[model samples]
Target chain A: MTTKMFDRIALIGIGLIGSSIARVIRREGLAGEIIISTRRAETLARAEELGLGDRYEQSAAEAVKDADLVIVSVPVGASGAVAKEIASSLKPGAILTDVGSTKASVIAQMEPYVPSNVHFIPGHPIAGTERSGPDAGFAELFQNRWCILTPLPGSDEAAVAKLADFWTACGSNIDTMDPNHHDMVLAIVSHLPHIIAYNIVGTADDLETVTKSEVIKYSASGFRDFTRLAASDPTMWRDVCLHNKDAILEMLARFSEDLASLQRAIRWGDGDKLFDMFTRTRAVRRSIIEAGQEVDAPDFGRIAVAKPAEASQGRD
Target chain B: MTTKMFDRIALIGIGLIGSSIARVIRREGLAGEIIISTRRAETLARAEELGLGDRYEQSAAEAVKDADLVIVSVPVGASGAVAKEIASSLKPGAILTDVGSTKASVIAQMEPYVPSNVHFIPGHPIAGTERSGPDAGFAELFQNRWCILTPLPGSDEAAVAKLADFWTACGSNIDTMDPNHHDMVLAIVSHLPHIIAYNIVGTADDLETVTKSEVIKYSASGFRDFTRLAASDPTMWRDVCLHNKDAILEMLARFSEDLASLQRAIRWGDGDKLFDMFTRTRAVRRSIIEAGQEVDAPDFGRIAVAKPAEASQGRD
Candidate 1:
C-alpha cells in the first residue's frame, strides 16, 4: 500500500469510465496523483468538485506532462484530436492507454500521434453503468469484469503486463484478442443489441394505434427490457456507431436477414420454428449465467419489486 | 373482509398465471375454495405439493363443477378445448374468464363453447415472469400491474364488476378494451418485443464470425438484456405468436420497416439521423420509469450486482 502503481495517472476525460478509474485509483491508492482533463470546463469543474483527481488541467497536453500513465477515455470519434493534443507532452516511458469500445478505430486514431517512447496499449475494461458524468461513477465498477487489451503486435511485453496488472488491481480479469476480432465480437454482442434496442424503442414510440402512455404503462411485459439499453447516452452510442460502422453494419444486416426469416415463420404460423428458436436462445442465457456474465435472478432480478404491466404469463 | 370474492374458483391450468392466481386467492382469501386443474397429472401433483389450491382435479370439467368462478389459464391455442370441457359443468351464472395474451383468438376459441347462463368475460392479467409451472407463481405476481379484460357486448355488468373487484383485490389495476384493440396494443408492446428478442438471439447464435461462448462471455454488455426476454417459456410464446398472427405480423412489418430506415442511416453515416432517433427513444424509457412501469435504476437495477462485461462506457 505504500507504493503506488503509477507516480501519477492522467485521465483525459472524466465521464463514466474516466471518473470510475479515478474513484478506483483513489480507493486503491493506485497512483500518487491523478491529473484530470476534459473538453468541457463544466465537466472538469465537476470532476474537481468530486475530488476525482488531485489536479485538474484544462489542457490534456498539460495533464499528461510528467504523468507515468495516461488514460484517454474520450468518445472514440474524438480520439484523434485528443491524441494529437497530448502527443507532445506524453512523458518518455509512460504507459498510454484508452478505454474506447472500438479498438481498431481508436488505435487508428491515436497510434500515429504517439511518441516512440510512449507505450500505447489499447485496452477496454468491459464494465460500466448507463449513467454518465462525474457523479455517476463508483469504485467498484470494474470488479469481476473483463478488461480486454488489444495490444498491437510486437508491443512492449513489460508495458502490456504492467497495464494488465493495473487493470487486474482495478478489479478486472484480462483478455487479449486481435482488434478486428474484438470489433466483430463487440458488434454482435454490444452494437447490434444496442441498435436493436434503440430501433425497437423508436418503433414503439412511433406507433399510432398504441399510445405512448399505453406503451409506458404496459412496458413490464417485455418492452421494458429493451428500454434500458435504449436509455444509454446518445453521443457515446453515436460515436460507437460511427467508429465501428463496418462491423456494426455487418451485424445489422445479419440481424435483419434473420429477422425476415423469423417474420416469415410468424406469418406462416410455424410454431415449431418459433418454439425451437425461442428454446435455443434459453440456453445462451444459461451459459451466460454459468459464466457469471449475468445475474441468475429472473427478470434481471427486478421481479422482487416487479411493476411491469401485462407480462406474458407462462403456459399450462 | 369476511366476504370472499367468489365462493369457489377453478384454475384450469396451474402454470405461471394460473398458479399465481391461486396463490393470490389464498393470500387475499379471495375465494372460499380453489380447485386446481391442468392437462398433466404431474403438474397437478406439483400444484398440490405447493398447496396452491384447496383441491386438485385432473379434469377441468370436474374442477369447474359447482365453482362460482373459473379461470382458464391455458395457452391461447388451448382456450377452446378448455372452454368446451368445462362449459357443461360450470355452475349457473358463474363468472368465466381467461388470462390469454391474444384476446380475439381466445374469445373466438372459447366463445362458441361457453354456455349462455355463464358470464364469459375474457381477461388477461398483463403480468408474469419467464418461469413456468406451479412453483413459479407468487402471490405478488400481479401487484401494481395491469390486468386487461375484454368482455363481450351485452355481458352482465354486475359480473364484470365482480371480476374487476377480484383482480383489484389481487393487486392489479383493471383495463377494459375490445379484443381486437387488445391484440393490436399487445402486438406492439409485448409481442413485437419478444419476437425481436428471439430473432436477435437466434441471429447471434448462428453467427460464424462470433462464437457463442464470446457472446455469452460479453453479454453483460447489451446482449444479456435481450436474453432475459429470449429465455421466456417457449410454448407460451409460441402459442402467443401462432394465435396472434395478424397483429404480430403487423407489428413485425412496422418494426422491420423502422429497422431498415435505421440501417440506411447507419450505412450512410447519417450521424444526425442516428442521433435524433437515439435521442427520441430515451424519452420513452424515461416516461416508462416515471410511469412506474420500469425500474429507474440503471441496467434494470442489476448494477448493484452488475456482472455484464464489455459495457459501453459513457462519453467524456
Candidate 2:
C-alpha cells in the first residue's frame, strides 16, 4: 500500500461520490481512519452495514472532531449546512474540501465557516455515473477521470499538495483552476447536459399523442442515451441547478439560442447549415476519444453483436 | 439454415443500415442472391471488398433489376430520387422498402414513383451506433431492437407480411403504425434527441470561455453522451431534420418551452420544482429498462469496475 496522507479522513454525506472515496481510501491506504457521516440515519446505517468506514458518525460535527482531512460530499445546496455543522469541531491545520459539481457555490458556502487555521480548498471531480447512493459507487470510479481543484489563492501550498496527492492516489489526473472558471466549465460539461436531458425526458413523458410505451420501445434510436443522464440522482442534480444558477443559466441561454438557429435552418430547409453543424460536432467526439476521455469502442462497447451459429464464413 | 426468403435482395445504399441488412441476409440465408449498390462508386467497391453481397453495382436501378426484394437504405431526402431512378427497373410483385428514419416523408417521397404491382413499404430499424459506413455494419445490428413499418393503405398484405418476416429473421421485433403517427413517434424518440444532442454539442463548440481541450478532457461528466449522438452520420441526420420539419419543429417548441420553465426554476432557486422534474424523469428511464428497451446497467455498463486486490468481501 502507498503512504497514508492523513491520520483521519472524515466523509460527510455518504452518497455515491463519498462512498467511492471511502472505498478508494481503503484500497490505497490513504487514511489511517475513515469516518462516514450523513444527515439521514438510515444512510449512515447503510454505510456502516457496507463497511464503508472505520467509524460512523450521525453528526457531521462529530465526524470531523479529530480528522486531519474533512471532505464534504453532499448536494451543493447542502454544502453550507454541512460546513456550518462541522466548522466548530474541525481540527486545526486540517484540510477541508468538497466534491461538489459547482466549485464557486461550494466555496461560497463552505469558506465562510471554516476556521482560520484549517486549510479549506474547493474541488470538483469531473467523474460520475447516473447511479447514486453508497451501493452505486465503486473504487475505480475515478480511474482515468479528472479531478479539478479550486484552491483559494492564499491557501497553504502544502495543504493543497497533500489534497491533490490524495486525489492522484485515487487514480485521477489533477487540474487546478479558478473557482469561477471551474463553475463555468462544469456548467457546460456537466450541469447543462443534465438539465437538457431531464427536460427532454420530461417533455417526452408529457407527450399527449405518443404513448410512454412507444417512447420506451423505440428509445434505442436516440432517446435512451438521454434517459441515462436523466435517471441520475435527482436530489444531487437539483442542488447543482440551484447552486450553480448563474453559469448554468448562461450556458442554457447559449444552448437555446443555438437551438433556435438550428430550428430556423430546419424550417427553411437549409441543408447546408444543418450539415455543417452536424459535421462539425463529429470532430468533437473524435477529439474526446483522442483525449482518452471516452472509450474508442463503437456504441461505447455496450452491445455484443451475436454471430451466426454456422454460416458460409468467407463473405466478410 | 433458414429457408431462403427471396430470390434476390438488392441493398441500395451500403452504409450502416444497408450493410447490416446485407450481413444479416447472408447469415440467415434469407436471399439466394445479394446485390449491393450505392451512389458512390467507392462505397460500392468497399462493399464488394467486404464481400457484403454477391453482386455490387454503382447503379441503384441495375441492382434492383430482377431483385425480388429491394431495400433502399439512404438518407430520407434521397428516397424520392432513388425511387425515381429504380422505378423502371423494379420487378413486378417485388417487395420494395427503404430503411429511413422519417417514415412519413420517406413514404411521401418514394410512393409517387413506386409501380402499382410492386410492394413499397417504408421501414425504420431503430438501431445504430455513432459509427456509419459499410465497415461499421454487423449482422446483429437489429438484434432485440424495434423495427417500425409504415405501410400505405390498400398495399399488398402478402408483401408486407413477407417483408415483416424478413425483418424478424434479421432479429428485429416488428411494429406497424400509420406513417404520420410513425413520424410523430420518431420525432419524440429519435429526431428530437439527435437534434438536442447536435444543438448542445454545437453550443459547446462555439463557447469561447472554455477551451476545446478542456471540454474534451472533462467530457465524461455528461457531455460525452451528447457527443455520441451528435457524432452520427451528418448526411442522414441532415436529411432527417429537413424531411421531418413539422414534427421536429413541434417537438423543439415543446422542448424549448419546457426548458424555459426549468430555467426559471433554477433562476428562482426552486429546488422542489427542480427535484420533482428530475425525480419524475428517473421513472421513465426505469420504465424503458423494464420494457427491455435499455440495459439496466449503471453508466450503461461501459466502465468495468476495478476491484481491490484484497478486501473484506461479502459486503453486498
Candidate 3:
C-alpha cells in the first residue's frame, strides 16, 4: 500500500463520483481514515454496505469534524447546502474541494460557507459513467482521465498541489484553471451534450410516426450514442443545467444558430456547405483519438482502439 | 476457418459502414471471394492493402459480374447510380442489397434500376464507428448489433432469409420493417442525433467567449460525445439528411418543440417538471440498458451489455 496523503478525508454525498473517490483513495492508500456522508439515508446505507469508507455519518457536518481534507461530491445545486452544513465543523488548515460538474456555481455556492482558516479549492474530475449511486463506482474509473482543479485566486498553492497529487495518484492527469472559465468551458463540452442528448431522446420519445419500439430497435444507427449521454444521471444533469444556466444558455443559443444554418443548407440542397462542415469535424475526432479521448472508429466510438499507430498510418 | 456462405460477394463503396461490412463478412467467412469496389481508386487500393477483399475493382459493373451476392455500401444518394451501373452485369437470381440508412429513399432510388431476375433487398446494419475509410474495417464490429432489412412487398422470402442468415452469422440480430417506417424510425434514432451533435460541435467551434482551447480541454464533460457523433462520415450522414428529408424534418420539428418546453421549464425554475422529466428519462435509459443497447456507465456505453437478462428482456 502507498503512503497516506491525509490523516482523514471526508466525502460528502456518496454517489458515483464520491464513491469513486472513496474506492480510489482506498485502493491507493491516500487517506488514513475515510468518512462517507450523504443526505439520503438509503444511499448512505448503501455506501456503508459497499464498504466505501472507514466511517459513515448521517450529517455532512459530523463527517468533517476531524478531517484534514473534505471532498463535496453532490449535485451542483446542493453544494451551498453541503458547504453550509460542513463549514463550522471543518478542521482548520483542512482542504475543501468538490466534484461538481459546474465549477463556477460550485465555487459561488461553496466559497461563502468555507472558513477563512481552511484552504478551499474547487475541483471536477473529468471522469464518470452515466450510472449513479455508490454501486456504480469502481477504483479504475479515473485511470488515464483528466482532473481539473479550479482553485480560487490567492488560494494556497500547497493545498491545491496536494489535492492534485492525490488525484494523480488515483490515475488522473491534473490541470488547473479559474473556476468561472472552467464552468464556461464545461458548459460547451459536457453540459450542452447532455442537454442535447436529453432533448433529442425526449423528442424521439414523443414522436408519433416513429413508435418507441422502432426507436429502440433501430437505435444502432447513431442514435444510441446520444442515448448513452441522455441516460446519464438526470438529477446530476438537471442540477448542472440549473446551476450553469448562463453558460448553457449561451452555448444553446450558438448551437441553435449553427443548426439553423445547417438546416438552411440542407433545405437549399447546398451539399458543398454541408460537406465542408462535416469534413472539418472529422479532424477533431482524429485529435480526440490522439489525445486518447476516443477510439478510432468510422462513425461512432464503437470499435476498439487501433493496434498501433504504425498499423493505422496511411492505410485508408 | 468458417465455411463461406456465398461463392462470391461484391461490396460497393468503402466508407465506415461499408468497410465494417467487409470486415465482418471476411471474418465470418460469409463469402468465398469478396469483390470490393468503390468510386474512388484510392479507396479501392486502401481496401486491397487492408486485405479486405480477394479482388478489388474500380468499376461496379465489373465487380458485380458473376458474383453470387452483391452489396451496395454507398451513401443513400449514390444507391440509384450504383444500382444502374451494376444492373446488367449482376448474376441472375443473386441476392442484391444496399446498406443505406434510409429505406424508402433507397428503395425508390434503386428499385427502378434493379433487374427483374435478381433479388433486390434494402438492408441496414445498425453498426458503425466514427472513423471512416477502408482502414476502419473490423471483423467483430457488428457483434451483437441489429441488422434491419426492409424487403419490398412480394420479394423472395428465400432471398430475405438468406440475407438474414448472412447477417446473423456476422453476429447481428435480424429485424424486418416497412421502408417508410424504417425511415421515420431512423430519423429519430440515428439522423437527429447526428444532426444535433454536428450542430452543437459547430456551435462550440464558433463561440468567442469559450475559446477552442477551453472547449477541447473540458470536452470530457459532455461535448465530447457530440463530437464523436459529429465526427461521423460526412457523405453518408449528408445523404441521410437529404434522402430521408420528410422523416428527418418531422423528427427535427418534434425535437425543437420539446426543447422549447424544456427551455421554458428551466427558465421558470420548474424543479418538479424538471425532476419528473429527469425521472422519466432515467427509466427510458434503464429500458435501453435492459435492451442491451447501452452499458450502465454514466458517460459512454461502458456497460453496454451488463445484466444480460435485463438487456434482452426489452426486445420487441
What digit string (tens of lDDT, one per residue) describes model 1 on residues B1-316? 4758888999999887888889789888988999989999888998898788999989999999999999999888899888888889999999999999999999888899988999999998888776677777777778889999999999999999999999999999999999999999999889998988888999999999788888987787888889888888899999999999998898888888998898898888899998998888778877887887766555532544431221111000
Candidate 1 residue-wise lDDT at A273? 93
lDDT of 3 by residue, B15-113 (tens): 766777787787777788989999988888878877888999999999999998898888899989988899999899999998888899899989998
**Cα deviation of A115, candidate 1, in Å:** 0.5
Using lDDT as the measure, the top candidate is: 2
lDDT of 3 by residue, A1-316 (tens): 6579999999999877888889889989999999999998998998898899999999889999989999999888999998898999999999999888888888888899899999999888988776677877777677777899988879998998899998999898898888778777888888878887788878877777777876776676677777767767778877987888888777777777787788777777778888888877766655665777653333343333222221111110
Q: In model 3, which runs have C-alpha deviations exceeding 4 angstroms?
A: A296-316, B1-5, B296-316
Q: How accurate is candidate 1 locally (lDDT)?
A: 0.85
Q: In terms of DockQ, which candidate is strongest?
A: 1
Q: Is candidate 2 or candidate 3 better by lDDT?
A: 2
**How do the residues A1-316 of candidate 1 rate in per-residue lDDT, one tens digit apiece?**
6648999999999988898899899988999999999999999998888788999999999999999999999888899999999999999999999999899999999999999999999999887666677777777778788889999988999999999999999988899999999999999988899999999999888889988888988888999888888877788899999999999999988988998888888888888998898899888888987997876655522544332121111000
Could you give the candidate ranking by DockQ, starting with the highest?
A: 1, 2, 3
lDDT tens readout by residue for model 2, A1-316? 6579899999998888898899899999999999999999988998898899999989889999989999999988899988998999999999999999988888888889988999998888888877888877778778889999999989999999999999999999999999999999999998899999999999999999999989999999899999999988898999988888999999999999999999999999999999999999999998997888876656622463232221111010
